[model samples]
Target: MSEMMTRENLTGLYVITDTTRFQRAALVESVSEAIAGGARVVQYRDKSDDVARRREEAAALAELCRRHGRSFIVNDDVALAIEVGADGVHLGRDDAPLTETRARFAAEGLDAIIGVSCYADRLRAERAAAEGADYLAFGAMFPSPTKPHAPGAPAEVLGWARERLGRPVCGIGGITATNVRDLMAHRPDMIAVISEVFAAPDIRAAAEALCHAMAADNTESIQTTEDPETS
Candidate 1:
């Protein structure tokens, strides 16, 4: 991981969610619970075209993350991220290029943290690193309810990315406590979750359990495995 990402001392849980799924009270409640359960990053991803609402939700999430001493990231909208004074923004491939994104944030004096979604391609991951993205994410590792039709990324790609990108790498999609063990060997800097936390019956416990699994010591076990599918 780059010294920039490592400097934050962030590990384990990162939560991404939409505003409609969580009202004000529920959003605050869930965030409080997740932070208490060890979430170090909270990403607000609202795909709606309603700019006003997106701004509102981003501001709220940024405030919550700030209160908890965690990083707040706005998904897909660099403008909204700046408007809300968020810690950073997460960009998809189709979004603004990292160079432009960084320049925009820097112009605003934000020093924004930028993360790119590289899916499962090593080349794309390498490109993101070269572009100075603070982190790179891959997955839909399992059947994710948020994006069910999204193809899964191989678990071992995490190792390939860790070696090449040298930046914090995140695994997203259908991550959960039960199957997260599959990703342990890759040693990602963190895991980005959606329904696993908000949709859980007990958000706090679910967050805690997932963080524990990610933090478990399984380096030897994963390396010894004979999965030719992995790099």
Candidate 2:
């Protein structure tokens, strides 16, 4: 694994938001606070069909992430990501094929930080890695009300992916500071959360707390030079 895709560099929390009832300015303010508190990545995942608004929001978040030196990912929308000059794009199982996405990113001269939602099972993750996915996502670990449509992934899947896949692995769905440490035993490359950070009473504090806990528990993977986290 490369340094940019390592777990240590991304040991902190990642926040994803669709539509917050809060005003856009307030949402941006909260996001800024979260970044200051140690959010490594922020993904804008609006499912709305409004192209102009999507482009605008993507641009705004891209600028915010740029200023904070954090990565910005556009979820499930390659065209919008291109329009906003986003740092990366995330794909679901039903989205475009990995080869097509890679080719698109290559054409643009971008690094193509493509993340694949593997849902569950090592087979999917292994396939994604073999196909050149930048990161592999596993879970719905706990019951994720945010994505009830997602299939549940076993806790052991993280360990399997850790041992089997060379690509960075991210555990998502209902991931909180309390349960996140359990995943450390698996040595996944990253953890992705929705309500745990975004829906918290204090987004900034929540993000920082998660980062601190993961940092402490991730000592082994991050400290060992041979571990990909230290790569």
Candidate 3:
């Protein structure tokens, strides 16, 4: 794994690929642009049944992320993640059990970064943390076009996870540059975005804007914490 993708370094802009929006070559090109624009983590999310095509795209993306020194994650596909030598896998509620996934990685001599989607459920997040999830994700922070029907997770959940879970918390779904500050105010370690970046007219510019916004918020957070008057 690249030094860029350690458990301690799982912060900043996380971009998830939208296969429905881009084809093979376009996907690679868009991801390259996103990385250039400061996307620290890239996840390949394809729910298609075309196994061969999925493998091909994932392998290409894994290599792309490795070349760019970014974390590469396969969404809900542990086998594909292992086959493509991804840095990790992000599992959702319907995905394989975390224990089994860990065992699979251990058997393969890989220390995989596993992220669990807790949606809007704090109890689920607690359970996942207890089960040793490397990161916990909560979402639909706003109305998400990608998963429009996903459960709404209040911004407060980010704060709760950060203060109590002791794991990297990622705020995902419907995050855009304009409303990201609202989520950032709660102090999530990372923010996951999809259509806002991938479906933009200029992928790099969209990604850069999101990164810049988050950086600005982080700076303000640090300053406020350091200044006694603000406390």
TM-score of every prediction relative to native? 0.89, 0.87, 0.93
Task: Give the lDDT ranking, best first.
Answer: 3, 1, 2
Give stretches of model 2 more than 4 Å off. Answer: 1-11, 220-231
Number of clashes in every candidate structure? 0, 0, 0
How high a TM-score does candidate 1 get?
A: 0.89
**Cα lDDT over the full model 3:** 0.88
lDDT of 3 by residue, 184-219 (tens): 877889999999898899999999999999988865
Consecutive 10-residue window with the lowest summed lDDT within model 1: 1-10
Model 1 residue runs over 4 Å out of place are 1-7, 217-231
lDDT per residue as tens, model 1, 1-231: 011333364456889874667866677788778888888888888777877766776787787777667888888888888888887889997898899999998888767788889887767888889989888899978888988898889888777787756888789999888788888777888899988888888889988988887777445334434354633
Model 3 weakest 10-residue run by lDDT: 222-231
Off by over 4 Å in 3: 1-4, 220-231
Q: Candidates sorted by TM-score, descending order?
A: 3, 1, 2
